[model samples]
Target chain A: MKVKSIQCKKCAAPLSLHGGGHRIRSLTCEYCGAIMKVQEDFALLGQFKDQSHPDCPLSLGTQGTIKDVLFTVIGTVSYRSNYGDSWTDLHLYSETHGYAWLSYQLGHFTFTRRVRYLPSRNMKQLSPREILRVNDQPYQFLEAYQTEVIHVAGELTWIAKVGDTSILRDAISPPFMFSQEETENEQEYHLTEYIDPEAIDANFELEYDTHRSFVHPAQPFKAPIRKALSKASLIPMALSVLFMFFLTLLNMGNTVLSERITHSQMTGGLFVQDFTINNANHLVEIQFDNAYGSRFQVKDITLFDDTHEVFTFGKKLKVKSSTISSQQGTAQFKIKKAGKYTLRLRAITTRKWANSDRITPYISLTIKEGVMNNRYLKYLFYISIISFLLFYISRYFFNKKRWE
Target chain B: MPNASHYINCPQCGNQLPLTFQYAKLTVCTHCDSTLFIEDDGVRLAGKQSVLSTIPSLLELGSPFSYHKTSFVPVGKVRYAHTIGYWEEWWVIGNSGKGFWISVDEGDFAVEKPLDLDSRDVASIPSRDDLYLGQTITLWKDQWQVTEIDKGKCEGFQGELPKILKVDDVVPFVHLSGQTGQLITLEYLDTGIEAFQGEWIDPFEIKREG
Candidate 1:
């Protein structure tokens, strides 16, 4: 590459202005370190004989390529916070694309470019929970403050005077950072992104190790890992929901063996019914449709397989209102003979106000038998729950890696 | 306004004035403090009397500095007294022959240039009472705040100013600050309205004329 012919005003050292320095107003001497103001010629502006810049591998005039575009180093400016934290901004210029910056802090690099547009909302509208979205990506607020220019060097498009301050607000979405810097004359928005140094070095065919391993603030997880995790999380949940729907559709139909449709008024006596089981190892469902919302008194409710005493229980239900409902009892067992079985219930039914002469509450009963796989579906549901938890945990960690 | 001339004498006080430009519409007689109006015939009394007094400042006429890529030399100054104290405004002539201003209140300095009405969005001039500190007004597509409000009178004048200034003239003005320390000063005078846009530049960042 050809270099411009120029001379430092102070030390008379040979210097060259690269990357279209036509608008540049200042350049520092590489020898005596004198700040020179450029116009038709050059004039000495200041001196910095003692201050040292940040130690970094790249220096002024380092040329590098990114995404097939070549960028030349032109200048570097340093800014400081009130707490004394400082960072250097390397201004890079492309002959066809104009200017951009690389923020260097402790070996970390963030590629930045000026933003061309902004959201309509103002700064005050940015809430803690709010993530301002641009290009379908949400940007979370990081910090905001006024930073002072502490140091400056090399050729620049505009005059960068030390001690000048600017208002800045920063936000980030993994791999990307958004900033608004307001100088006295103009407000500019910029976007910064984290790039893998290994990729950059590999693309440029450089021998140096630019691979940084430290966790940067806006560094993103590997694309493949995040994409796979997201897919693993979503696909299983969707399949489980669809399977649940299928199980529900199959479980809706039940075969009724016996049901009493006629109203049977209880006269405070015991009632017994002999029912036969047609199949072995099947669920026997006994149901009672109750009305009048009355207190039910039943004693020694029992089921017997030819007096073998299969199952016995007792219960009492207190009546509340006229809006009555049904009751059910289910038992799944092998009857062995698949023959005669008797269900017996001793009960007294009455209303809360006996003197009111409302007719005694009528009771109804139904018996149903079916082959059910409710237990298996329940086990599958629990397994799906575990998978849901696993997916979410992976997602949480993935998002943390991507954004924090 | 008359064309350029070498020299002329004040009609009221017979003070010889070294007039150089045709656009020097209004000037002061240094010997008698009489305001003179330069016209085609000659320098005549501006029909005004001013008992002016000077204020001490760090920057005087002919002080040169570079700002916004333009080299300028301070050519004029106007002093105004407020309720709290006094502030001075200096008009600097640029290499392009255009004019700029530098305001000094206490120790702060602001580099300024005149703004046309088309550069602002506000339709009408706001009343003095309507302007308060912390109020915001948009100009040149950026928001600026009214940081100061003062009712002052012209206390002193010197050199060739963009506009005429007479002692004891009512100069009600407001100072606005942008988010990044830019300044917008609006001066309301009986003759007309004037607006100047500027930014607060640090003295340490400036390199004096060598």
Candidate 2:
């Protein structure tokens, strides 16, 4: 509420020093185009006439709280790059905290503060992709550009001229940027962080263009849920792998019956055997081994518990080659009762015209119980891998957009 | 140590002024704003110090404030005018009965304590002519980078101070920054060079006491 009142040295217009404390050096009259040196009895330094004012939502002496510190907008400097890019920087001041900058460019806002920490190398000497460390954190060099001051108003920490030019270099470690400003007399470093438009609107209560057409280099990626899910997916992925390992270890079951049936043991093209299943509520596997050249077909294999039939399985087997080889086939079923079971198999041999002699073949059969099934865990492991990849892929593209 | 109840009459205004600290060297008369210099022989009138403009500040003269759970009362202040503007340093008495300095420049704040350097250490400090900005200097086994080298003059004073200061007397100083917001300042005084070491303090962390 307390401010210094002075009259313009040229136009005699009333002026008020709202902030910048005792450190400000110059104040420019908005009514007339005269710049006065505040330290030297309001002496006229120079004049900038017919300069157009840039679009700014906040006016001089507008108070706003940023990051828990109340600051007043004391000055506005509009700059234009050689590439035709223009932005406005608002000089902010606090009684207890010092001076800072709120820059608005392309519908984006960023808050910047001068930092004492020095970069590892000079800003002009840095190459693209080269990292510069400030306060022990790495920032990648983004760009370097030349900007000239086009318009200025109100009070500033230093003297302002309309045509003053400076070179600025920027480096980013996203959501944060390190900028180096170099002029003819001085070089300084500033650390800037991106601020959301909603936050700025809430604090300053200004309505301007809030639509951003491109992602800012300092804007943070907004997919927090995806990032969290990416981190959380590792837990399920690890558990599934561990369970698959344990299932593999318990894959082989106890062999309950192993027998060989000769051609002479068969009666009327049928073979019968009695097997005792010791473990119930387990997967029972029935496997058969035969010679490679045999053309015998397994018409039916039946399992009976006492008088009722439990299950039946059948397969036709044809030998494609006879080059001193053998083959095996297996069938699995879950057994619920631990009791004596009878197995019956019916087979028929195909007759060939070239061989008149009866070449009867023998078969080997094995039965086992308590084998583990790991089909569902395999599917879960695949789904977890897919989820992990999806989250990271989205993050990668988001970062790529930011850098681009 | 001087008596806590020690009082002196201003030579210029004839007002009673209290010497609250043991090493008090100068006290400004609240009645007429005359600066009084305390010497071994007697108190002498230095000059009149200009009253600074009222600005909302975190620490005020004679006001107790708590920082990092420790309480301190600012007894005096000296404002120095530089090329850019001005900065003020407050002389405060801590809860432990020790005196320290808190400097406020623009928005930056620092709490400093006087540090004694040996003859060898004093000799190693670069002269004012040889120092440059961004140059590194090793002190107290730590590397410090020179941030600013400026020459300022005493603009005014208020309350009491432990150092003899005159209005418009030129004082050159260099500011250096170390790891973790640490600061080291070297002032080129007429007697010699004086050094103080401390760390930067956040203004928000200071809690004012009524």
Candidate 3:
């Protein structure tokens, strides 16, 4: 389709109509800001002067291919929100795909196309945070604002003036945003998708700032490694916990010996108990309990195989507190020999207000075998949980910033 | 099945024109750009239509293209000039021996098939003045929103067409869109109201068949 070159009706400035076909209704002169109605023999519509041009990099007739469709920039409209935020929308026309828009704001670019699908609810009735399904995809309303056409250049599909305002509401479903624009006469819906600045640059073969200052609502989070880690850690984390639970149920060993020693049975402050060991493949536990408030101390606990000391644990255990009715402690060790094992305990007094020989405490001792140590499994579970949290926390913050 | 061919002489230029489709009502003489209207009695020269200028396009007359895995050969085309620009409707024949219209307005493309108003329980269609943009109406057992209401003239034509069209004939058409991409077009012609039902086609999906 060829566009005829014409002079501006108001300023007589030479202008070449590169595109927009017959759909564009108004052509604005970039020199004197004169808007002409293209259908009415280029009649002067209005003059909008003293307006600043937006920093748009794409000029009229700049051709680019987006999603395999070739489009040319034919018009530009600069719009300002009610809150003073400004952006530029470049009108794109393709000979085969009709009109579209490339919006640029804060170093971000998004492609927009008019959609016939009306929102489930009216634009004015929708509030922020409300979810509306369009084409079965959920879109959450982001904001509603008034957009004023501040400046215009090239050609537009409608007769846009400097102060033409429309109430625009936007809803986002990541990678895609649905916008509803309502004027006094008509309501229109447009679908926009966030385009990476690098993609825009590559498509047009031009350098752009590409330094986005804020996260766009339609921009998808791109942390592939973190997302993969978060998802991949879940199975192993669950498996580690399940293994620990099953290990605890299956490793409860039985007790082999239980004995009691009286205080008067000590001759040289030594009490001996002979216990036979059955299985030496697992761990062994020796537990002792003494009468509470009895001022006594155990000097040494030794396991001897026919008077040959196999293991000696010499730790002083004192029971002095009167509040505790009984004092208990346990010691664990690995034993190899399965023959007769004799355990000996040496006792002494720790109190000065009583007779040293008569204040010996009565003690009860028990020996258990085949116990399983699960310290390594417990550490593995903790590590798995921390690794998952690290990835999850990063992704959570990334999403939070995107929504903000 | 046996294939049949039809030929006619241009009343204006005495040039022989081939009418490939049996239902072809109009054809343009390639030698003199004369529009030949085929009637039940005989062919007559309707008028001289302007020759279409060369432009980059996906479909060409006598060329086959595949859309949605179905091959269609364009036999004729009619260009309608609107207020801002022009749109072309191509008369295409599918591999199944059915004929359809492929409308290309700027970049918008639609494959439209003629709809019988009586079969769809539609007794009448609203006049061009009675319809407005964004207005919804029930037709063909579905609700359609009026997206555009425009009047154009038959500016130029080429090859063969399925309907009798004269040069500079006023064509008033209304476009309605469904919730999905379905489209219903109503053309108020001199004879009667002609309706077409179709869906929007993505231009990228059309592949030129060799």
Judged by DockQ, which candidate is best?
A: 3
The candidate, 1 or 3, that scores higher on TM-score is 3
Model 1, span B1-210: residue lDDT tens: 212247778787777776533366667666786777677677667665554454344455556766656667666678877874566787776667666788776435678999876424344657667778878876567787888887877887776566766678878889887765577888876655778887765432344474
lDDT of 2 at A253: 90
Q: What tens-digit string does per-residue lDDT give for candidate 3 at A66-144? A: 8777888888899999989899999998877788999988888899988766677665777777989886898888899
For candidate 3, give the docking quality class from DockQ: acceptable
Q: Which ten residues in a row are the worst by lDDT in model 3 chain A?
A: A315-324
**Which one is best on TM-score?**
3
**Over all chains combined, what TM-score does candidate 1 have?**
0.43
- Put the candidates in TM-score order, highest first: 3, 2, 1
- Across residues B1-210, which tens digit of lDDT does each residue of candidate 2 receive? 223548899888788877877678988898999888899989988878688776667788877899989989888888888886788899999888789999998788899998887888789888978889989888768898898999888888887788888888899999998855789899988889989988877675688886
Arrange candidates, best lDDT first: 2, 3, 1
Residue A301, model 3, lDDT: 79
Query: Clashes in model 1: which pairs?
Result: A290-A325, A294-A319, A295-A319
lDDT of 2 at A148: 97
- Candidates' C-alpha lDDT: 0.65, 0.83, 0.81
Computed on C-alphas against the true complex, the DockQ of each candidate is 0.01, 0.44, 0.45
Candidate 1's residue-wise lDDT over A87-177, tens digit each? 8888776653456787776556778876545644464457533578654577787666789876777777677766789888777777887
